[model samples]
Target chain A: MIEIILGKYNYWIYIALMMIGFYAMIAKENLVKKILGMNIFQTGVILLYVSISKVSGGTVPIIWDKGGPYDNPLPHVLMLTAIVVSVSTTAVALALIVRIYKSYGTIEDDQIVVINSHDGDKEIPSEKASTII
Target chain B: MIELLDILLLLFLVICAVAAISMRDLLSSTIVLGSYSLFMAVVWTRLNAVDVAFTEASVGAGITTMLMLAALSRTKRFEFLYRKKGQQEDPNKETNPLLKNWKRKRFSVTKVSGLIVVLLTGAILIYGTMDMPDFGDPNSPSYTHVATMYIERGQPEVNVPNLVTAVLASYRGYDTLGETIVIFTAGIGVILMLRKRKKT
Candidate 1:
């Protein structure tokens, strides 16, 4: 009964995490909050994949004379690449944010749209507006 | 039977996701997202698909969150709500007080359509999952093919116990290179979008 409960618990946890992230992304008005939610959602995917890779009583991927079989190593390698890629992307995204902040004095989405659409004739460049600021 | 550790890890993922979304601050969300990705990377370790896990950890959790935060910093921190009370006067229409120099416009249909498209794509993904194989079964066709090949001859061919790495870096080296190119393209796109033009 304990084992069954534990198994059910794990399943529910994964589902809960997935839902939380999804809800946050959908409901949050704060741009940063949405991004955070996205992170949560992606993490959920990672958890699901990792959980699926386990083999009961399996040794680490390293082979030894006493071992029956080794745990799979493919997931680890994939994850390493993923980590590196995520960091690189983060760096670029942060750079873009800096640029955005420079251009728009305000980070409120509706305000920016209001400012941009006010020009009924000539198009105003975001850079130009920021320069004026 | 799986170990207790697996259950705990899954629980952790749930907690992080819930907290990340529930939190009011965007910065905290991004950070939680990063943690979420790192945890997912660990999950990849548990699953035998080390390569997929690596991609998820790096691209999904790491780069994606960073990109999102950067986008937020440039864009509006808060979404605007429309006001209805003050438009009664023909000559005294209330221009936006917040953006004194700018004009205000209502939300467009394009944005709504774009959102609908996103919802449809998500629905498709959920539907696709129904046809997938149930977890890890040695008798499954996927297990018998390339997955089994790696399990059987991975040590001999690449001398690496991690079959995913061997396959990604060696047998499917070209594919990995292509993936790298795609990432490069994304970087280029962000750069292009943000590039400042010099005034003549």
Candidate 2:
């Protein structure tokens, strides 16, 4: 049990981090909070990949005079691209959130749904419709 | 000693994650998320992933936070509990019992269901981790495959001191090109979504 805990605690902690993000993404009513959760979820996956690449007694994957042992470089390279993609995703999501706010006057997911449902029952006033257009 | 540092850093990460999600103010949550990224970068460095640490510090901690703050400037800062205009105007007005009950309680059915789903998925993922190799095991299968080839021949063939850069810029140049295109496409998408048309 001790050996398992020592060997796999990193993975367990990362899973906990991921679960927190997952809970926020699903349960949080605020749109921006959902986006924040998504960001945390992505970071957790990146952390898992980086953790997998570690080598005991290994230095960074930069070649020097003596270079027998080094951490895996592939995961690092992959995660570098993932980090950039994550930022790009965030930019797009924020843009959509801004547009959503412009139309609905609020960034809460439940409020947006309420507005949409209300739209079906009674036509939105002309001035509000103009802003949406 | 290093393992202890790793555990401490990860603990900090969990705290930051919880705080970021739980904060009522969106701006404060964004700032807390930035600190989370910063700690994540330090953890990456301790794990010998210097290149990834650099990217996480700049892109995750810096750019993402700035973008979130800019969005917050354009939107409301607080996650206000939204009530219908009718409810605000006349609290005594009769409404559907189900809707009224949901509005009164902080924890709705949606929240409880979401929590259940998240817990179920997390349990499955943790079960899957049982087969994974131990952390930092030098002879793990991940290090024995193409990773070994990349580390062995990367410096000699690519003539770059940093194996990560060598692989990213040369060995996996096509992949990097694809990623660059993804970023470019995302940029164009944001511009299209946000750009205002001239009055015609």
If scored against the real structure, what TM-score would every candidate get? 0.63, 0.89
Predicted candidate 1 versus true structure: per-residue lDDT over B34-63, tens digit per residue:
786677667656654456655766677666
The whole-model lDDT of each prediction reads 0.55, 0.87
lDDT (0-100) at residue B105 of candidate 2? 42
For residue B38, give model 2's deviation from the true position in Å. 0.5
Chain A TM-score, each candidate: 0.67, 0.87
Clashing pairs in 2: none
lDDT tens string, model 2, A8-109? 888888888889998888888889999999999889889889988998888999999886698899999899889988899999999999999887777777
Residue B22, candidate 1: how far off, in angstroms? 2.6
Q: Which candidate leads the pack in DockQ?
A: 2
The Cα error of candidate 1 at residue B24, in Å, is 2.5
Candidate 2 lDDT at A5 equals 74
